[model samples]
Target: MNFHRTEVRHRAVARLRAGAKNADVAREFDIPLGTISYWRHMDRAKRGECPGAHDPKCPRCDGRELDSAAYSYLLALYLGDGHIIQYSAHRVPSLMITCDDAWPGLMNACETAMRKVFPDNSVCRVRKTGCHNVKVYSKHLWCMFPQHGEGKKHERSLVLEPWQQQIVDAHPWQFIRGLIHSDGCRITNWTTRRVGGERKRYEYPRYFFTNTSTDIIQLCTDTLDRVGVEWKPARQKSRKAENISVARKASVALMDQHIGPKY
Candidate 1:
């Protein structure tokens, strides 16, 4: 609640410096995990340990420190470019990592979580095709773009790849909610959605992504569901667009209601 509490900030930084887990510190202080990470990152920047601050020409520039605005931009870039951008502009292209044995890690991680949350939900490898070009690798963070409707606020109409979009559509609530819950940061007015010129039906809705500590088991189960792919209505909605609005509204409402600033 108190965003600018210096003592809390200092204590969090100290804990991080002492090699404590960001989540642990966040849980202890009843703050969003992100707030703790932001503070720790800021502290690290002050000490000249940030990744982007690796410029020998200018050992340090305060601008390299990721303030709120920079953080949003970085998030956008990650989602839009799949964390690693290959191209942009009129023909935006990104390199989706690929490998044969890469998926085991992801599958293992997601499977573990699915068992806990939904025991009956099982993950199965449906098929394999070279033409489809299924590639997988491991990374701390991933890119995904969320979707938004007309008259709503979100990011621009950038198209992330199919797999990336599948990840988002399947688990937007989990992705955003997990971040807010895990991070101690409270987003005052953040909108993690994508906007479009017209209301056209895109096969995929959004991008699904994760942080370093994503639950592999849960992720695996969720991914299976995504692969299987179905849509359902929220309990509460109007009659105007019952079928279409349910999925859209439910997705947005969950993100908006529970995925705000937290610690």
Candidate 2:
């Protein structure tokens, strides 16, 4: 069997992504037409666009039962620190979430949720200076993440569809966990007190979620309320209502049990 070098194959795929016809790419690269077609097929399969062989069987497209728990969690991650890039008809879109490298477990969980949500698609991680980009390319991402739009997440009007709302209701903790992993954190505040003639340090743990999108913030707080977890507006130095706090002892305990620290 004849084989092309890695660089040649990459150029061929780049041509395909640029809307060049298979035969044209084959002619330009001196590759067999059938081989070019196979390459195209494999690329589409990796993106979950191929049917039967590797299709993701998108719930919205094929009426498959959506993995509600995973979908809810991924949705929170997308809302918090992710973005979807729209592509032309010839190419598939990509979903990317930036995860801190310090929390390798969070990166793994994020990739796991993506795989569960888009079962047949391949997820990849790209490393940055201090973080990793967990990404998946698929034609059906927009169908699943309907909140994807033209601009930044906070700049756009975010609303949940009825079906998505149902999932959030069912797996509120999972959703909260994803959001915390993406844009929230659990921190400890300590103070030294004199007890029995000795200085003792007491630590208080709390959860905080910060987001500029009012709608997303509302969604998080609403889910917190549904689960009987209390939260309040967290005032920052800016004095804006973009921060949320779960500081009550009981609420913090619940968060710790369900979400915990990033790692």
Candidate 3:
């Protein structure tokens, strides 16, 4: 395969930093073993450290303590509309959460969550085709959130680790709120009814969450159940995705008490 020098170097650096053997990296990247050795030497020399002799407590690269609320929010954003990308040219992986350009509040929440997760890293906003994005770069971020992977989320098996599940269990409301804010919406729904002798329209508020991943939908429903908010599942018009609706007056009221509506 034809590969750019920069791309090869980037891959080499990432693998080395992740503690892969030179032979393993060469085999994985399909590069010459000697070339891999040379890259490793150059990388270590640039850092002025011998191979495998780097400090584990390097302030910039060490993992941070997980903030359950912040991480749960970030996780929902990720499962809903966020993706992680690692390019051969970039030193650190990037976590990006894309929101509708019109929803500035949602965008701000995403940025805040990322900053809370990686307090030392800078979060930046970028304008994309029809949405705005909040992004942060950190080498250790992916270790904490290992859900990052290839292919569409629905096509993959989504499961939370034991530690992550514990966080969700302790802060299910925050988790549900994040999921709802990202993939769900609150709207005023109406129905026409006959009262006394005249036909009248009655309006009620409801929440609807739609997503392509069944596992994610199940997670939302399970969390709502745990929080005592009632909901019902429905198939989306496309048939490719599914949704859950919380429309019962009492149920909506309960959700309002817990998740509420994202501003």
Indicate which candidate wins on TM-score: 2
Comparing 1 and 2 by lDDT, which wins?
2
Clashing pairs in 2: none
lDDT tens digits, residues 1-263, model 2?
46577788889999998999999999999999987897899788778787766555789889987789999999999998898875444457899999988999999999999988888788999989999999999888888889988877778899999989999999999999988998899999788999999999999998999988889999999999999899998777554448999999999988888889988
User: Which residue ranges in model 1 land beyond 4 Å of their true spot?
Assistant: 54-263
lDDT at 191 for candidate 2?
Answer: 88
What TM-score does candidate 3 get on C-alpha atoms? 0.78
Q: For all the candidates, what are their Cα RMSDs to the real structure?
A: 21.1, 7.0, 7.3
1-263 per-residue lDDT for model 3 (tens digits): 33457866897879988999999998888888877887787678568787554332222245436677888888888889888887654346788888888777888888888888777677898988888888987767567777777898999988898888888998888788788888899999899999999999999999999998989988998898898888898657878879899998898988898777777
Tens digits of per-residue lDDT, candidate 1, 112-227, equal: 33233222223233234531122222111122222222321212343445644444454554443332222212222323444575454334222223222223223323533553
Report the Cα lDDT for candidate 2: 0.88
